[model samples]
Target: MELHILIKGERDISGQIYTQIYEAIESGRLVQDQQIPPSRLLAKQLGVARKSVADAYNRLTYDKKIVGYVGRGTFVSGAAAAPTLPHIEAGKAVMGSLKKWGEHADMTPLETAYRCAVDFAGGEPSAHHFYQDEWRSCVLHGLRQCTAKRGKYGETAGVKQLREALIRHAAFSRGVIATPEQMVITNGAQQALDLIGRIVIEPGTCVAMEEPGYPGARLLFTSLGARVVGVRVDSEGIDVDAIPEQAKLIYVTPAHQFPLGMPMSEARRQALLEKANRIGAIIIEDDYDSEFRYSGQVTNSLQSMDKFGVVVFVGTMSKVMFPEMRIGYLIAPPAIAKAAVMVKRLTDWHSNTMVQYALAKFIADGNLLRHVRRVQTIYAQRREKIQAVFGTALAQWFELLPTNAGFHMVALAKRDINIGELIARARADNIGLYSLRDFYYEAAPPAGLFLGYGSVDANAIEPALIEVRNILRAMLWQQKT
Candidate 1:
């Protein structure tokens, strides 16, 4: 490799070399033990005198930026390292949308499950349930395939194989039908929502989301400048009538609602679809974590039921696989997909292609189905344990919301207790508990706790709940006095 040094306007050539080398070392571009050109060779290369180069080298050595061996060339000193960058505060001219996002954001504690002994925070999967060997094999396959296509840019729509694989998986698993052209793979369901938002949302655009719905989704739309209104959710999913007529976008978690696990009834699904068709609005169906159902009829995806091209079906491997996997797909209507594809291209020009191929192979080889079936039984056992305990001992303080699908179940508090205090106390006891309050926007959501059985072992469920029962008892005793 040639190292070119410019000698401009007969200025100090040696000084220029010294400054460039020092800056490179300080910026981490040059690392320790890296060799520099011979003094004579460098001087000849720059058309400068050997004495000038030697003088610069001597100065650098005294400063400990470079060290020279007797026989070998000069190398960057071990002491030479990049300095830490200082944090800069945002300027006054920063975007107003960024300020709004900060005001509305809570930084939802998503991966807190692994940090505590007993965790009830939802939307995580068990490490023990992940098919490591199978996934590793698929990753190897993806790497081999990726090596052959190194210099090329891929389609923003995504790798063709992965799109086809997602289409097949969605058809059988969720009863949703789509072609390769209709689907666009994303970094996660979160990004899919963002792309869809980019396509439709404008300043003051009306967006309807389920109250106490996914907080992450709420923040995304809010940052996109949507006037998000919270629609009431009941025993039957999101209330169709409560949705404002002006709302151009509707987001729902129908197959096991987030934080509150309740599959939308068939009648309610029809009503929602009819309402969306009537209002000329687009619906985003985030069918996350509903694949691990224990009992009841497997609900068809809203996209499957849509006679009108309104529903944009979104699904993620994060909940089914580990949270770090970060692969999701969205099946949208033709016009929306065309717009979403263009938006996705402008945003990032496509997601990571290698991981997409790995997931595609995972789904194609039947590993994904096997993995889900394998974990479904384990989750069902944990769910049953929570169900049995909530009936026998937990009935005094909370009412278990009837749910048969997903890794989490919500329990509405029977009476008002200091939830903030309860959470802090639980954390002190080495248990991770989360409240549903953060999910609500306009009004205070009903007091409840989302009991996720994903990370907690089945055997530990009762013991943890027993400890919670004791804490509640102590709290009630104090409140009465």
Candidate 2:
């Protein structure tokens, strides 16, 4: 293939290639889905290392400017030419030509809608947790230690030091009694879910999941060919009575349910554990956002109460620390941990070692605990600020639920109002909130909006509420017309 490399000044070899490709796409020189040369081939042509080309491809992928299908190779994303819809879809629709693979599929219009001048999207912690000085200190120390020797892949399970650190943290903070050998580090809880799904969920197996639950879990179970049955959730948490005994796996966010922000009551947790053991089914407990409880003494983790070893505890730093950290782990039974190690080794060959080392030191030095405490204070204040704003702006048409803990809350829009249309209006004003209707499997359960407050600050809350009120008010006018 003839190299169409466009060198632009002295911005480094990789930068030149990246800019040329981007410009080519914008200028119509590269058509949609056009195949690109292999990274190795491109690197050889440009007289640079393949790593440089890989880095360029990674940047493009993050920007959604290119598509890289595993095994099939990289191409100009066909989504570049896809037509836009005025409103988001009520259900999943084909958005582009990309073969839907993983959890990004099945997201509805309301699930994805909401744009914001200041985004308060769910499942994110504040950037303050990624303290540059703290990260740099840890990175420098890790580099100094690695200077003597690059740590070889220690165990298929994970690095021992990190596992030991996590075991202590879980015992003290989460009430889960786990040993280092019982834990396996993952690329965040998403991958933990994927690994467990791979090992336990055979094609077409029945899995019980809470209704109005985490879509990420729902998508993973569905993609793995699990027959996902939605068990309705109530004030306390997932209705233990509603879940079927035949389910092979029961997934729950008992620490704090996603989107809904309700914690599983102790009674419900005990019932679920008893029921799960009776049926000999595996319980996957996703302890998401458990670190930021603002209420009374934090609830004990479901895994802590389990004597049957049926609960597979999934823990991640994504909510408490930063998502880029990509360090989550699963505390599995001795039987499952070995199988999980084999599956994980085949998947990604363990997580990034440098980050793992840094995380180990971070926890050992007690900085992670301190950081979480600092962040919890900030999130609690922001949660209150958002509640006050919601009260003033949405009082007449909405009832805000009390989320004493966690970074998000739920608001039930008036029964007469269309939740989807209201969200679209909010998007027009540049606010990307989410709707609770998208959280359920049924046609309708409860009509409400899921508001994430941690990502935004006190300064941005009132103005955001103004925009939200305006959007809802305009939505009413449109309905009247």
Candidate 3:
């Protein structure tokens, strides 16, 4: 190892070397068990006599700071305690320039506790039912294949086999038709949104989305300096006529709108496509958590109905499998898809190749479908339990939103109630509840609770809701008095 010891002026050579080495050890620059350069070589490099280097080594060994072996030369015995440096506060000017949208952004989603006896955290899936053995087999196959191949950076668009598998899966399941070339694999739906934002949004670009939409998408657009317009959403999903005429991009969670849990109506979907075509705006369809629909007629995706090539459909495996898998894809028109590929290359090159390969095999081997079917049954039972409880016990205080798809449902407060206080009280009782206020960007969001059935098991749902009903009744009575 090369030691950066500076011996300047007419100081005692031996003492200077000793002090420098000691300081290096004390500062943790010289770690324990690290071999030092030979005394002869160090002396030659430092332009000092062998005696000076020898004296320094002798002192360090005597003090037990280092150990010299017969043939092993010298090695640091142990690391010294690191010295504390003077703290330097960031200057106001520097701090001011670093202020971004995230600095003042709503942090409710991140701050909310996830673990509880009854968790209603939206977008979370039950990992307890995952097919561990099947997934392990697929992963081992991918690993073996990857080990045999040349280790280099894969394509930015992602593994070709996975794209092909997604094409088949999307076509068979969501009615979205796209070739492998039109898709770009991302880390997750969030990364897909970020890539789209990077390619489409410039400073002051007009972007329109649902009023109470996904916070992740809203925060992404805001951080990019886009002029975001919040379009009002009804029971039929985002109101098409409310969107600005000059919007370059319109983000929508059409399969099941975030927080509110309503699918976009057929009439609204057609009108939205017409409006986007007339205005030359691109639409981002985030089809998150549409795989497990419990009731009502299943609706085709906006991308499947799109004739003008204005829709970019984004989907994720996080809801179907798990969030930590971090795999999602976007299907776009050739022009936008090509640009998205380039943007993805610039962002992080590509996602995990092994996972992608494993997922491709998983999908091809029918394990993915089987897993979704298994979990769908579990989630449907929980959803039913939630609906039954709400109908019987809590119907007076909360109005359940009409929802057929997705793992979560929203219930609006029937009477005036402090949502913030309710959530705090619920937390105190070991019940995790999430509010809808953070989903709204520019509109007065309704007072509601997003009840998710993904994390909480079927057996626990009724008990949790029973307790929630008692609490709600008490709060309502207190408010009246």
Candidate 4:
């Protein structure tokens, strides 16, 4: 067998040979029990003295990095392995030429705290409410169907049945009119955003988003070398005039603006569409959590209002169903949809066929609609309970934002207080809270907490708020003293 050991000009020849061989073993280039070249052959190849090769082999043997049998040649040992160290060096010098946006991209999955009695972390759905038995039956049926068509790849756009189901569901519920061919199924809304960014954003391209917007979309665009512009959002929703004219893409949570839950007014939505048309920009409408409106009239999606094909509608089942299901769809124009399908094929060759088939059945059999209707009632009660408690007890510290939709709401701090300190203190009291600062990309966000009712039990909310109120009172007292 050929070995890749190098022998230097005489001085430290044995040491050099030993170092190279040891490195090769550690890096897995030389695997366990793989025989090394005979010392005589290695010496002849390197034009070095046989004794020097023998010496290097002896040193490696002493370190247990290699082993030899009486009849057989030397082999790499199981003990020879790479050192377990921090993946990235913690210094600026090592991160040369790393893009600024890449530095800000946090790919870590959101973790749920096991120790907290009440968790207000946003974007999580109630696991207890999921119809496990029905869902399992659907999964089994999907598995059987998938097994029947073994060895064949499903469509990149999605399973035909699922797309048709989504089209019907979207049209009936959200007023979004799109055929199955215009939709592309993705892993989640994140991947949909990534695909849009891939096709649209070039280096130095302008991407406009709300100031306190979805950090995931911002990070995705920024990482793709787009100059992300933060637009101010008011109670009416994203200010249409505030968006940069040069922006190629605009990301908006129009149905329910994230953190601050306010659906875009119809007039504002029309103005946004006009602005996008005039500027030739693509609007990504992330209509998340529009299913659970406790009160007020439902507004048609911006996609339904589009006449010029500028709005690309993106929706997710994660918030309505469960996060782990990882199902989302994008409705775009035929041209963009074709390109996106090609990109989707390149990305992962389509999302999980089995899960897609299961979700299709779940929606078609009206289980999804039934689930949403049931959960909406429960979430409505929880929302009222939170508002009642806050209006009476916790209103002194927090000014609750006006919202009629979505599972979460923001409580802006009434006084000058450190939200981080408050979060830390609340955790000690077994309450989980998140800071609004986490969502902001440019502007200095107001101090606040995102109180989500999706994951917390309806019974535990009032007591949790009481604990939160106590913490805020004590903190305010400390600040005054």
Candidate 5:
């Protein structure tokens, strides 16, 4: 490869060449095992004597930075691996801030060292549910209808068609009552939270989040400079008594808790609302993927029960559709509805125009609900298989938590077991597993497995879980030994 070397003056041309090449190696411009140009070629390019180029090559060889084989020519044999230059004082401060941001980054569906054949990672939706043919038609319809005004940016509050459709969908399905004007479509539920945080949170604003909650929401608020307080979650969901009265914003997954799957008891929900009203706090109710409940009293969204107009309801299609379809919406409490819409406008100036329209049509034409119903049956079956296996094959080891809804469920280990080691061993046997370790903002997270069956097929469920049981048994036996 041609190395860029400038031969300025004829004096000490070889020295200049050697120094430049050395610097190149040091800077990683020339990496290890990279071939350099022949001395003769370099000499001709540099308009210098071949001997001068050869002398430089000889010096590099002597330093063991490069070596030449008879036919292979010169290659970078040895060089001090990539050298780190001293950071500037200004850069140090920026890097320190970056490190702080890194600490608050989202941790979910963790990347395992090995690719597991049967992955039980949370946040994945089943492809069996994806309305490929129906969605294709909807998208084509959207492209035709939505692009009529192709030059215009979509409304920050989402397209009119979507807002209207979502209003109907939410009311019928989740019992959420909202006007089209209050709906602010976002990139995803994640963005909706960010927008809410932007309007309500200032530096050191007191925000309460469910401990062992969705790490994504916790980190998002943390990044926004909110003083996030972790409230303990038990069988009834976030312990309302545990939340500080001063917490300005309270984020809760009331329908189904994240990582640890437990719906908030109605009494607890009422108590939480009273607390919020007493303290004048806004509640962010993330009703993510509550559509696939197997068996339980059909719980209406917190928005339906909101009398004080204090709850900002968030919903996403990612769990119902594929996760890559980054679309979600938020129904702001009447007081902050305009403010949330304004913040959304400033944040990204609205989401994908065509996508919003396509989703609107998908919902309006009943494709979305039909898709959900079909998949709901399949998912229920998968959930049943996992429950049966854990009940029969895995009962001795795991106590299945009380959960009746969502793509995943929680099962606490029967005794003190190394949850981390259990995960590693399961992964080794080609089953990706997760515990509720990373979600905790507090030090002590409960010992349990968050078994998600969304992507796993019904027939594959028993075999995969059987293998998991086998591995767990071996681990337990080894421990006894």
Candidate 6:
């Protein structure tokens, strides 16, 4: 039973789980009448979420290759024959390529907020958004619909209602106006990035990204073999003047630059759009955390300002809603949407339509909007609490950057402290502080650590910073010795 499941360079859990099971059956490794491992056991073996394994099993059952009876275990169907195998040595030859990816497996480190040690980290939203009654109710409603359409391949363009609701929501919230037909639902913003890269990026194409930008975006573009060019960002967000006119695409977090916490000013936004028009470059506007703005009205998204249809606006529910939701959308220009949809159709088909339908009902009913407002009020208070902590002891050691928006805050470490040593010591204190170098390419590593404030409770701020300050003190002592 020489069975190996391979998902090459993809972070998708759903496919990995399903593919492993499929490969085992197809390669005569999992014979007909063989009892498949229970979902929990397989999930543990693969180091994946249990929900994913169960979903894969359910998919297999729908295909009639596996079946189950009440009070009995699941088994491969008798009608299904074990697939014939190639010569043993021929199979062994491909093993190296399969094992090569094991080193790059994306097992994200445990974020430190669970320990209540770190005060500033990236990607933390206030806990008010978590376990909210409305969100749970929405999930329940979503579940009810899933049971109705349990075994169906979802619509390739996503559920129509969800697409329509997204159009209304975007116009009202982000100022992007588009027909429902012009948007494509995705598993998340990450998938949207991947799909866009697949459609546009060929080997060696130059893609411009903001320096000190979202690490995920940079990683995605680079993974596609695009030579990533970093454009400098400033108080007004990505510097349009700094971007080379010849680049094929530019990725920017204009609403609130990741980690930098700066909004692209009107002039700069216009300038970038104008430049994009002149150079025929595509602008990827990531409005990931804009829904949680602490003060003032949420600015119009770049998609809304695009007269030339050059902006590809990306949004996600991971930050504003929940990470597990895995729902995001790309608001593309009509032409790009047509191209992206063709690519998406040949790929995963579409994101879970049941979930999309439920989200549609959630948005159309005004529950999502109401929930966003409620969470915004609570995060506003938490933001103030975090700011107060930074003003005291931490301020003496690091300079706090201007933060007009987003969940994370940036701190410029004083030169006297060794940033890397401070990070290692801080982690030992159970504090999770990330450095800017983690987000940069090897040729150029940016300085500083990203501190996510959203995940930290308001009450825990002082204690977390105390641990961080003590760690810095210890690092200073080590340097003196």
lDDT of 1: 0.86
Q: Return the TM-score for each candidate structure.
A: 0.87, 0.78, 0.85, 0.81, 0.81, 0.76
Q: What's the number of clashes in each of the models?
A: 0, 6, 0, 0, 0, 10
Which stretches of model 1 miss by more than 4 angstroms? 1-89, 95-98, 106-114
lDDT of each: 0.86, 0.81, 0.88, 0.88, 0.86, 0.76
Candidate 4 on 1-481: residue-level lDDT in tens?
Answer: 4688766577988889989988887777788888998889999999988898899999999999899888987888854454444476557864654645356645322465374788887888888988899999999989988998889999999999999999998898899989999999999888899999999999999999998898888888988889999999998999999999998999999889986998889999999999999999999999878988887889989999999999899989989999899999999999999989998899899899999989999998899999999999889999899899889898878888988888999999887878999899989888988888878878998999888889899999999999888888898788789
Model 3 clash pairs? Answer: none
Alpha-carbon shift of residue 101 in model 2 (angstroms): 4.1
Candidate 6, poorest ten consecutive residues by summed lDDT = 101-110
Per-residue alpha-carbon lDDT of candidate 5 for residues 1-481, written as tens digits (9 for 90 to 100): 4578887877999899999998888778788998999999998888889999899999999998899999888998776577656675556649878778666553443455654788887778898667799899989988997669788887888889999998998898889988988888888999999999998899999999998888888878888999999998888889898899899999999999887788888888888888999998999999998988888898868888889889999999999888678999999766587998888777788898888889999998999889889998988898888989989998988888878888898888888778898888888778888887777767587788888888887887788888888887788899899
Residue lDDT tens for model 6, 1-481: 2224454554767777676677677776778887777777777766667888788888888877688877778898733364676765537878875554343244223344355344466675555554466556776887887888888877777788888988888788778888888889998999889888888798888899988776677767877778889888888878888888778889999888876787888889999999999998998998898877766556768888889988998888888777778999998888888888888888888887667877887787788888788777776776776577668767778877776676777777655667887777776766767786665542375456677777777677777777777777776777789
For model 6, the stretches where C-alpha displacement exceeds 4 angstroms are 1-120, 126-128, 131-133, 143-151, 296-298, 442-446
Evaluate model 2: give its TM-score.
0.78
- Candidate 5: regions farther than 4 A off: 1-90, 106-115
Off by more than 4 A, model 3: 1-97, 101-108, 477-481
Q: What's model 5's TM-score?
A: 0.81
- Supply the TM-score for candidate 3: 0.85
Per the 3 Å backbone cut-off, how many clashing residue pairs does candidate 5 have? 0
